[model samples]
Target: MGIRPLAKARTSFAATFGGLPSGFWWLWTAQLINRACGFVMPLLAFYITEELDRSAAFAGTVVAGIGVGSLVAGPFGGALGDRFGHKPTLVAALGATAASMIALAYARSPWALIVGAFVVGVTNNATRPAHNALIADVIPGKDQVRAYSLNFWAINVGYSIAMLSVGLVSFTGYTALFWLNGATTLIGAVMIATRVPGRARPAEPTEAEEAAGGFGAVLRDRSFVAFVGAQFLVLTILLQSESGLPIAMSLDGFSPSTFGQVAALNGIVIVAVQLPLTRLYKRFPESWVLAGSSATVGIGYSVLLLGDSAWIYGVSIVVWTLGEIGNTPTSFALVARISPDHLRGRYQGLYQVAWTGSAVVAPLVGGWVIHTWGAGPLWIGCLVVALAAAVAQLGIGTRLTRRVATKDPEEQPEPAKSAPASDAG
Candidate 1:
């Protein structure tokens, strides 16, 4: 933690970015645009409730519809990525997402909003897996962790900017915010389609690879199944913050602004910590890191049960963010490592299906729990869920590590190689 060591860590992170493949910068650009637009959800919800004259409950249902659309789209998107290639899929998804956002902006009725949400959800959810599969195709194995971390960092930065912009502009009109969101998505689509080079699919995989059968075959792998399950639970715990934490914090006398600040802090922490930690953990066993991260998140939420003050809650956010930084990139890297080359998109889609499915359920359930029980009970319930996920991680950690270690070396990309530095602007 000394200045010298911190400087070294920073240098390492900087160097890793310097080494990313050519297409990565385009992917990063698209991610930034997508995430900046992503920050409009809170404003979107506000617009639905205040301007559209929808009840809060109805708005929540529309949001849940978005999740359902994403869940339904994931596997198909993954399959499409595997078949048609990542760049084409990314372009199509982004274009559709932008169009859907425009339609959503004009939606007048609750059903219309739901339909728009579903359209947006299906398109947007496809973007991630396609983008990730492209990265997995281009980047070296050792560099994948840094690539994912940088991607997340870009996302959080875009999110922070978008959130700030929405706050500033929504005073004018939420429709304006919606317009801006759509514009950004369109820009992202254009960037990916024109700027990023499409990854070349490996010369058609042999009969064995074909037999691997996309996500369906991937799902049958016991270790992969367990890993996906653990990821599902982690997402369930994370979604509670969006759905349950606000209600819980309101009950504890925290203002809406305070909740926003805490959530922003979570993003900032991830942006700050993810790269350095990814480097630090690169040499560690992925499974152990995942298990420990899960345990940390459970501990953090449990600590929230003891807190009534803003400072205490802030500390809990830090703890949970640390856990997030530790878990997410490693989990993604594992997926990339284990999946068949042709099926990376399919696997990522399946993984995202787990995530979106949890989003669909966690909010409704968390909201119901808050409405029925209270803050204390809700926090305890989240803690239990986190711990359960941790236990699941513990059960599968050894098996996953073994699977990773025993994999044929030829399946992985070469050791990390430095790319030529970008032109100094």
Candidate 2:
């Protein structure tokens, strides 16, 4: 019995993860390294309010600096990646991320810490546009969803490790948190520089293509823009898991260690179910999948109104994590499908802006709500925003279906190559 189940598990693993290109795996490995110690951002609120002895409002402002930086980086990073090369862009950005993290660790003064957070946001986010672009560049479109799903799983796995480590070690201090994060980010940079291939630049755009490309063209995409807006709404709710949720728990008398354990549960649930659900969700329409997932996230967070027990928070995290599992990879795949190859980076960058941009708004609003009113109103508001986002997503789904039905043969994206050229190590 045990032997048969073990064999079945092996087969499932192979079916789920097998056959990606070397470059994709290298990219996956690099991201795993970077995220494995990605504890700082999630816990930055605690560090500021508890360690620095700042107010919740002040922490929100500092955290908002990351959003400000991300908003700036998204479009520019994508444009640079499109104009130059993804490999070089990632190398420079990751190196900067490492330096900025170290700088953030040592910052003591209010102004210094605020500036450090902003710089950390810029360098940390600048890689995302190129990262997603490279995936679209290399992976066959049919495989991009699976690749992204696996990547999401890797992210949660890393988050689980990071959070659990924080629970274990954070009592010592958070200085090591920034240092470890920086070191891992630097290693990821080295991995990219040494192992990933420099993608061959595409043929220069023709007159029509030139007219349609760049940030102007991306902005002109009304459908994509609306989709981004819905994304922003949903992210405003989800990002609270990192920013507002921790502070809420702390105010309710939980320790940072307790918060870390609960936050780690979010990752643990994702690590367990994300891949399997990815396959399951693929069977449904993208729009309905997203709508349902958004609703699920809202319901999950709303559960917080019931109580403040560790068990209640754990349930909240798990329920929302299920929604997150369905939402992230499915949404990314949809974005990839809708985007033109020439504008993949910008599309991804704009997509990233939805999340980072929410970081800007969600924290400021959530902090104020928690400080001024209470956590109750904040959780209530999440449900309202999530329902609105779900409605918007359904409209997007209908439009996407119509767009596909009406698309001309010539309008279809050129088939991507099986794999990108890699630098021989």
lDDT of each: 0.76, 0.80
How would you encode candidate 2's per-residue C-alpha lDDT over 1-425 as one tens digit per residue? 79999998998788688878888888899988788889889889899999889999999889888878889888878877877777778788999999998889889888998999999888889998888777767777556678888888888788666755777444658887788888999998898788777675534677898887898898988988998999888888998987789989999999988897787787778877888787676655667778889988998999999999999999998988888888888778667667766777778889998977887788778888899999999999998889888988877865763464344333332221331112000
The Cα RMSD of model 2 versus the native structure comes to 6.5
lDDT by residue (159-253, candidate 1, tens digit) is 88777777665466777767777788889888877878776453366898788676668778887887788888887777777778787788888
Off by over 4 Å in 2: 1-7, 39-64, 103-114, 167-180, 247-257, 305-309, 370-377, 401-425
RMSD of 1: 5.9
**Which prediction has the highest lDDT against the true structure?**
2
